[model samples]
Target: MEKIKPRNFFDRMQALDRRYIYLVVALSIILPLIIPFNSKTYVTEPTENVYKKIDSYAGRKDRAILMCFSHDASTMAELFPMEVAILRHCFERKIPVFTICFMPAAKPLMDYAIMTAKEDYNVQSGIDYLSFGYKPYGLFLPILLGMGDDISEAVETDDQGRKIDSLPIMKEIRNYNEMNLVIDFAASAAVYSWIIYARAKFGVNVAAGITAVMAADNYPYLQTGQLTGMLSGLKGAAEYEKLVDIFATHRDENGNIASREFSKEILKETWIKLSDIQDRRYKTARIGMNAQTVAHVMIIVFILLGNVGYFVTRKKDIEPTG
Candidate 1:
């Protein structure tokens, strides 16, 4: 009787149970969320541009950034962080901010973003920032156009039903002239309305915070200079979060603040640990990225191992017997 040979490591791996693979993949994703590690977030040019644009208006009462909540809860995971990071940037720098939504579904999210970011800062509503709240879709065009002439006259009252003209923030921010930048966070091409009417008509700079899948669709506008900047999905959020941590929020040994212009080279040496971030809400995108990165690496490893095992086992099986 011929002696049977024991299977080698490659042979065993080649036939590894699919359930085991799934188990490992799940763990790889879950473990990162439970215990996130320090990771490098390379800032991209588009994200940096958005940061620079907002940073330019830092501490300026006459200029404010408008965040248009054009999306609902469906794409919140990617878009919410972008809102929080931008709001945190604004709060830290004393930049005036305005939020508005044409859809009723976006009203809660607009409030939530403000609530999350203001927790760590001593910012007052209608003074530091304002919310235009939800308007009917039919009124979207009229409101967009009217903001160019007069913000208070457009929406009249804020989400709180207080006359916006009565608010202190409106003293300088009367129209899109003062609110120079409008960032529409959407899952679709909702930004076109802003670009066509708000930017083309009023000359307000337009940027976007959109889901990753829709990013490609908007790049043309960025190239044409119609879109000022964009936060593309979770990656964009992660980049903005890193920028906020570095320039806006960082403090030295003596408790002195550190603020500087962002560059790709500077970001290379910077690594942010999720545990170090005090605000749990601020760490959302980075934590999500950790899980995504680990899962991708795990998948790559499985693919490589499967390929190696298949080739090695095939070669050995076809070898002539000694």
Candidate 2:
């Protein structure tokens, strides 16, 4: 009978060094960031619903989209991309976008998204878009209620201290009737306030853009129609980006744009006219999706290998001796 080596291949795998797995994972994540790969993302119902709602308001001057930034830097990694996607959609379709931040820390992020998303486009402040800046949380509820009556009085000035009522965009946007859609982005459960106060009182449709970990908590609102739709975390952001790319930019997958017929129907129904227009900027969430996918795959591979080693080694130990 052949003798087994003191440290056989199976034994080595059973006791594999943790450092090796760590190195593999690190490389798996880093390589995707370095390499530009075309990854397809599946659009979920919740994310698609948000896109559909925004698309429904395309080229409409009467109804505008209000983006509420209620999160700080801690959740920016997941939520910021969502902001950019929503902004790009609005900009592409020429929908007037209004932004407000209640949390002081969220003010900068609000500015960052506007500044970043407006770079390639000719979007100007007080004209195409407006930011209400940082309002105290204590006063936000009152301001929310007041906006239903008079937006200019509620948000007295833009972030730059300019009179909001004096802006070109504000002339048509008086209250929730004009600015109908409200999408709240938060790390915590800030959408509840928007639901209870903004939707409950004013009768405006509400939606949420949140991190995946916090997604489950908001599903109840989504189901009840309190939230018209939601974008849940990075995956949601990526899906929105894909939809934008497919509709506005005419980005095709290997020259096959009609691979997803559902998206085509959405484009037709939304009446988004495709032109030679292209967004030359890097799609952050799509790129980040690559890294996330690779990391997850690597972890699953490691887990499977560990399990195989455990089971194989156990079989050897359990064999009867002559």
Candidate 3:
């Protein structure tokens, strides 16, 4: 073994200031948001499956999609964009959509998605869309099962206490057969309830829109076809938004666009043209992805630098002294 020798470079590296690393990390998260830029999102298979499922109901009145918001403000950062994108797709494609909230606090988030997406076009509550807001937690399974018998008896009123059967849109959608798809958006394991009650009982197709952290736990369901599709965090939302941008972009007064013909073959070859988009709301997850990319890259770079410093200092310390 060689004698150790003192070296200025290794000494400086060993004494590096932690405050500098902290500053770099803080800047990594903030700078991207302050200076926003366009970023391309590669759509994943799970998210693409969600887009395809929603697209299948285009211009249909008898068949519809059910959205269940199971999250609150705490997880809005990941799940909100997903809600907006799905709503926009329904509006653009003229698909009948009904929103329900098992968690009381998620009602506001549900309202926000409707309010934001509807700003771009004319969407009426009783006619174009409907909401069953703030249903009790324990009653979720009962309400879901009850819908199979009579939707009106299970869900008696609208968010404002108007009769659900009185709504013009409700004339076509009556039971679980009419509402074929149920998508649960959550930050927790609440999706399991939907998978068990709504899907297992009535044979309704199930999907989930969830935060990235909880995504891994649900993959087994996807493989077994228990989940028809899923959206994981901001990245999944971004992918769904991109698909909607390319396909579902027009509708009629009754939410059916009979004349607007769409071809998936053409969309597959073309990149998403962000320049043509006017609504800034559709770009929320994309902008967030930019910030996430920068922060992740910065962390990897810092880790590499720290390791280099460690090895250099170790080599110097082990060298023979003069």
Candidate 4:
């Protein structure tokens, strides 16, 4: 039998179409999962600044967090982790959450979020948080939120067919004026609706978790102090996971690995990373890594290969084809 080995390290690393780099990246993340590598997370100065300010207003009896989903399946890759972690934190602390959807389809998505939150933390449904389904009317959103008792009076059932009045969580939440914090997970400029009607009109505190593409625009809101805190895409969610010591995906009760449920008070430190969250965020509809990130890497790879491929082919061309 002939022994085979590459003469050089570069040759050894060459991968035709095997996606060995992806395997390596996957292992870099997955090994940590199996071994439980412990690394203390650094509080990004941005999150710290937001944390101190957000922490100040927490723990109020009626203080609530309103998280909005203004996106479709395509944007979920970057948006869901941040949304889930923020929701977990709010529910764990017994903070009331009134999640809604400006995009309308977000209504079902929001319900899925609530169900996961409840199952993960064993949270009480109405007492802990409530998703008001996808209210189809964007124009009335402002009035529904800021119009006080009028909003609650009109909203009869929650997304799950529960009577809004019967919910212990909603029994007293009469208006947007009572909301302590508003966390908007947005994609396009659609979230501005909540900004104009909910926060500006009622003076409710606001925060946000937005996709990387849309995050730049929201910085103005942060600068204006219209938003108390914000998480920009998957990186922000990973940072938040480090803050709370949980993973987006975790081991199941039977020891089979699975996506971690959202729990405000997570007992076991989870393996929640932006990558893991992406798995759940897209769920049945995901493909691969972040497209932009992938493109950047491909660009670099191609640049190196171009230089090498050019030299190799040129050498062959210069030499006579005998």
Candidate 5:
């Protein structure tokens, strides 16, 4: 039999500072973003549901789909990954995406996201996809949708100063009439603008990607089938990452590695590659459990140490004022 004593001096000496734990948490998130993790995480049923919705409305080579980026730089960190994942799948499936933005400031965001996926997925611009650049429609998009006219006349050239009509992708896309799906990734209410114009007037099918906070705002639309489907925030992004077969070293909402440490509780394990079900379940269930795990463990240790110090001080205080 083996006897155990309290944590030894050497063991205590080896303990990590809570600040170090914070660094690990920060690095776990930032490191992946800074470098190309390119993990192969599998998508879930709900994520697949969005793809199925996209496919349901997609067809005809000239009929390009539109992706509206309504979120600004603040959300780029959380939303961009989901943007890339969506763009990757769409382009890989040979879907031509016409990127649009309702916010002038968001155009760069649209461009950054579009260009990254285009480069990474080998998606060619002016053919496979485009940035309709930014348009200042104000509230008239619904009127333009009904008109089925080129909104490009409003912004003559793209961000690069190239005449949009000259771009090959734009050559096929004139107005909402030429679009099949409107995939709006938003952090604002600009999503409703698409609903009015793209769906109501143009009769185009709609899909969306938004932060989890904005997600519930879209549910009634989902129920009414006004929006075909949506991916809600980073959790949604992780799910999409799985379907597209990209995995990184970071963990999910739970402390689990963004993928299965081993092959257990996975369906289609032989065929479906990258992330497995069990890996995402805990994180998704607990909501930032991984982020909290490293923090909470350290807090508990500090509290225990604080209690020990308090007890020792109490003994001295009872003996004398000194």
Candidate 6:
């Protein structure tokens, strides 16, 4: 009887069970979410600009930031964290905020953003922040221009059907003059409308929190200074989240608020661990980033192993007969 030969390492690798790879990919995504570790988030200029602009308005009831929810639920994974981070920053520092949307799909998302952020702070609706709610698409341009003059006139009532003029938030915020900044969160280039209309006509500083895929389209506006700043995709969201942790959410040893201005030079010595975050809500972007990072590394590893297996098997096949 002929002797059977044992499979070599290269052959075994070439024929490796695909199920194992699937298992690894699954674990790479799920493990980070289950047991997170410390990671450094390198802040970018665009994200830092948004943070600084919002921070500048802290404790000011006379000026407010407006968040325009332009995308629907499909892009929430990236945009939702941005909304939460901004809201948390505002609530932590007593900054007034206004939320509005023209699309019906975005109305519920606006409410959800507000609801999620409200859970952690003692903020009153229609006082600390107000939602202009949903308006028809046709009326969007008209209202957009109208807000430049009078916000209450543009949005007669809020989501709750109460007259916006009667809301306490409206006392100091009348038009784009008081609503100094407008950050539009979208999966598309919806921010251009604000730039062309609100920023050009009313002189409101426009910014954006857009999906990664749509970021390139808005960079020109950012460079032109038409945009005050932006949060681009998940990376932007993660950066903003980190900023909030370092400046807005931080507490002192005595449990008093210890927020500080952001400085990249000082951040080299500063570090924030995933485990240090008590609220899971605040960890959303960081956890998502960890999973993405691990998954990408695993893909690279698999590719390297495949190339090695290919070369090893090819070398053996081409060897002279013994």
* Candidate whose lDDT is highest: 1
RMSD of each: 4.1, 5.3, 4.1, 9.1, 10.8, 3.7
Candidate 4 segments exceeding 4 Å error:
1-42, 49-59, 138-150, 246-322
What would the per-residue lDDT of candidate 6 be over residues 167-280, giving only the tens digit for each residue? Answer: 888888888888999999999878999999998888899999999999989999999999999899888999999999888877889988888877776656768888877888
lDDT scores in order: 0.90, 0.82, 0.84, 0.59, 0.62, 0.89
Candidate 4 — number of clashing residue pairs? Answer: 6
Residue 94 lDDT (model 1)? 92
Pairs that collide, model 1: none
Error in Å for residue 231 of model 4: 0.6
lDDT of 1 by residue, 222-291 (tens): 9999999989999999989989988888778897777666666667777777787777788789888989
Q: Regarding lDDT, does 5 or 6 come out ahead?
A: 6
Candidate 6 clashing pairs, residues 3+ apart or interchain? none
- Candidate 5: 10-residue stretch with minimal lDDT: 280-289
TM-score of each: 0.85, 0.82, 0.86, 0.64, 0.62, 0.86
Task: Rank all candidate structures by their lDDT, best first, as comma-separated numbers.
Answer: 1, 6, 3, 2, 5, 4
Candidate 5 lDDT, tens digit per residue, 196-230?
76688667777778887888898888878888777
In model 3, pairs of residues that clash are 3-319, 3-320, 3-321, 4-319, 4-320, 4-321, 94-255
Spell out the clash pairs found in candidate 4.
Answer: 88-264, 92-264, 247-270, 247-271, 247-272, 248-272
What is the TM-score of candidate 3? 0.86
